[model samples]
Structure formats: C-alpha cells, structure tokens
Target: MNAEPVRPPAEAPTTELERADDGAAEPDATEQETAAPEPAQQELAAREQAAREQAAEPSERETAEPVPPEPSKTAEASPAESVPTQNLPRDPARASDVLVHRALPLIRSGELGLAEATLDRAWELDPRNPQAMAGYAALYVAAKDGDRALKWAKKAVRRRSRRPQYHVLYGDALQLQGDVTGARKAWTRALSLDPGNREAKARLADTSAQAAK
Candidate 1:
C-alpha cells in the first residue's frame, strides 16, 4: 500500500519591515539617528519635496482659472427656440378657404378689422383664387362699399368664368349698383351655365320685369 505525499502551500513574500514587525521592535530613536545614513535622509527629503510640489500644483491651477460670472435671470429665461408658424393644408383645403374659416371666428366676435385683415392676407396669398375674391366681395358688400364689392365680384367672375356662383355674385353687385341691364345679362349668363340655378333664375326674372317696366 502506497500513500500520496501532502505538501503545504507556499508562503507569501514579505518586505524587510514587515518581517521585523512580526516580533522585533524598531531601533531606538538615538540608535536610528546614529545608524541611518545621509543618503536615506536625502531620499526622505526628496519624497517630501515631490509631495509638496504635487499639492502646490493643484492650488496654482485653481488660482489660474478665473471664476465664471453668474448668469442673469433674464438671460436664462430668454427663449432658445423660435415659435412655430401654423400653416394651412396644401391639399383640396385651399389657403383662401382656410383664411375664410379662420376669419369667421373673428367676424362672429365683431372683430371686423381683424377679419378684413385676414381676408386681405388670403387674397394677397392667392390673388387669382375665386374663394378669396368672393370673401372680399362679401366683406365689401357687408361693409356697404358698393364700388369695392363690384370690383371684387367682377374679378371673382373673371378668375373662375365657369362658376355659376361667381356670375351670380357679379349680377348681385351690378343690381346693387343700379345697373339693371348689366345685372340681367350677368344673371342670364349664370343661368345658362347652370340651368337649375334657382338664385340666377329668380334674379334674372326680377331684373327683366324691372327693365320692362
């Protein structure tokens, strides 16, 4: 029968000071002063000098960097981003239509000046748009500016020649302006464009009778 040999683990390495600390006390101060060489003292002085240089470097750097000024409350509150503009849809919803709808709220609130300004901007954005001219024409009529109403109505008709409503508006403007013959002609044109146009038919008959009389 054979038995395997058991080996203890190897011991960790230890410094000379640590080995001495196990049981032996350090040398007395008088003994150290007599035994310690000048070279050791020079090394100790150099290590202290290096530590002092490291500590002084950080303080010198802190002094070199100037303190930043405190920020004003107004400066912090100033907006860094711009306000977004709300734009109209580009599809079948025309700019003129959007302007008209937007102006309605102002009109309802009796903000006629703002309503007119909105309509004016709409017309400027789309000068050839029938709806824009129609809105302006209606506004002029409501404001009792017959001359501007007639001008805008005629422009609306000229821009959308095939629209019966445009012709009807022109006829109404002419009627209001005392041009009975011209009104009858405009209404007749509107009726010819749309045979079932009730407004044009009624207006045409009324104007014709008035002219005959």
Candidate 2:
C-alpha cells in the first residue's frame, strides 16, 4: 500500500481569542501602500522640481555672457569736423576788389543799374577803397551824371593822391562839368605825375588849340 502524509486533526474555535485568530487576518491599509501619503508625496515632488530649476537657470539681472557697449548716438564731433570749411571768412578788402572788378564791365556795357548795385555792395565791404570810388566815378560818367561823377572822382583823387589814373579820371569829370580851368590843371598835374601819359598830353594840346582859336 502507498503511504499518505499525515495532517493535523481539525478542531473548532469557540473562545473569543481563538475566534479572533481563526478569522482571516485583515491586511493593514497603511502597510498596503507602496508610496508615501498623497499630500506629502506631491509636496516632495514640487520641492525637487523647484530645486532643479533654480540650479539650471541663470539670474535675471546678471549674466556671464559678454556684451559689447553700444556706440553713442550723440557723440561730440571734432572741432575741424564740427565747423564748415567752405565759405570761410574772407578779407573785406579783397572781397571789395573782386566786386569792383565785376562792376566795371557792366559800366562799360551801359548796364548802369547793375553796375551801381554791384559797386554799392563793394563799398559796403570797404568804404575807403579808392578802386571802389573810381569804379563809382566811371559808372556815373557812363550814366551821364556829370556832378555825381565829379564827386566820386574827387573822392578817388583824395584817397590816392599819387595815382595818375585817378588824376586823369578827375580831369575827365571836370571837363564833363564844364570846368575847363580845373580840368586843365588836373591834366597838368597828371602829366607831372606821369611824363608818358598820352591822354593828358592829347587833352592839353586839344584845349590849347581851342583856346588859341
């Protein structure tokens, strides 16, 4: 015959202590959980995430990256660059001479208004310029204003007493004003200043011949 394993004999539990032990042992709910409590676990995870972000992120106001300084929009200019080189201040006398030279051609062309305007600007630059005075004299002579011409010619002679050209201009103005004696005296003075003055010689010869007649 085959032998069978012996087992313990069954007995019924009837006492309170025996009954409690005999009932199926209930598993502790707290021991059954694999993780911590829900609230504590969530709080721990939030703290870990915040710590990771803080370590990885840079400060908002500061950085290790190099940034170049921007150029200023209102930087000061150098003295030479700040001021214009063109149209610098010119000498009044030289500017006056340029204007007077421009006027003489217009006078010869009988553009009296334009000549007078230009000479006026020259005079404004240099009031005592003898060339400017002589230019005015020529302009009035061309315009047939004998008295004005005489006035400006006299001013020219007063300004430059030794220039024979100015003396010739004076004599011409005197002749225009019908002052024959004054004109002859001016021509004689011009001849004394310049022995080679053909205009003075011719004028004297013409007047002497007229007087003899």
Give the best candidate by TM-score. 2
Alpha carbon deviation, residue 140, candidate 1 (Å) = 1.8
lDDT of 2 by residue, 125-173 (tens): 8999999999998888787789999999999999999988788888888
TM for every model, in the order presented, reads 0.49, 0.55
lDDT of each: 0.76, 0.84
Show model 1 residue runs off by greater than 4 Å: 1-87, 90-93, 101-114, 208-213
Which parts of model 2 have CA positions greater than 4 angstroms off?
A: 1-89
Q: How close is candidate 1 to the true structure, as a TM-score?
A: 0.49
User: For candidate 1, lDDT tens digit of each residue in 88-187?
Assistant: 7664337667877676566567666766887776666666667878777766766667798899998888888999888887878887788878888888
